[model samples]
Target: MKSAKAKATNYKACLALEVPAYVAFYKAPPEFLGDDALTIEVKYQGGRTEIQKITVKVSAPGGQQKI
Candidate 1:
């Protein structure tokens, strides 16, 4: 387990990629979602663990759609 002292609050994030692509994560102020596959996991300092998986199709801005 990773040890981290609690101040006012704390944050935890981890990323794993099976196939190589591109990934971007936004936090606070101008937060945004992605248009591709991603996985999010949240574990308390020493409590419950919650995970979420998102699947999305991606394409070029002005390219032909996949059929």
Candidate 2:
């Protein structure tokens, strides 16, 4: 994504626990392949911000794995 922004949503889980949650759906670039680096910025409801780095792995279709 060229530029993306996200907002955290508050959810009430079991036992009356309040938690911040986020859900994202994205489509990778058509020309993208192999391993790529993804950076995400998380903003909580308490005005807390965090930077997270994650790895995005892409592989060929029907690729076989050696035991």
**Stretches > 4 Å off in candidate 2:** 1-20, 63-67
lDDT of 1 by residue, 1-67 (tens): 2434333323344243233333444332233333555676766668999886866544545553331
lDDT (0 to 1) per candidate: 0.47, 0.60
lDDT of 2 by residue, 1-67 (tens): 3434444455444434434456554455786667766678987778999998776676565653221
Residue 56 accuracy (lDDT) in model 2: 62
Model 1 Cα shift for residue 61 (angstroms): 0.9
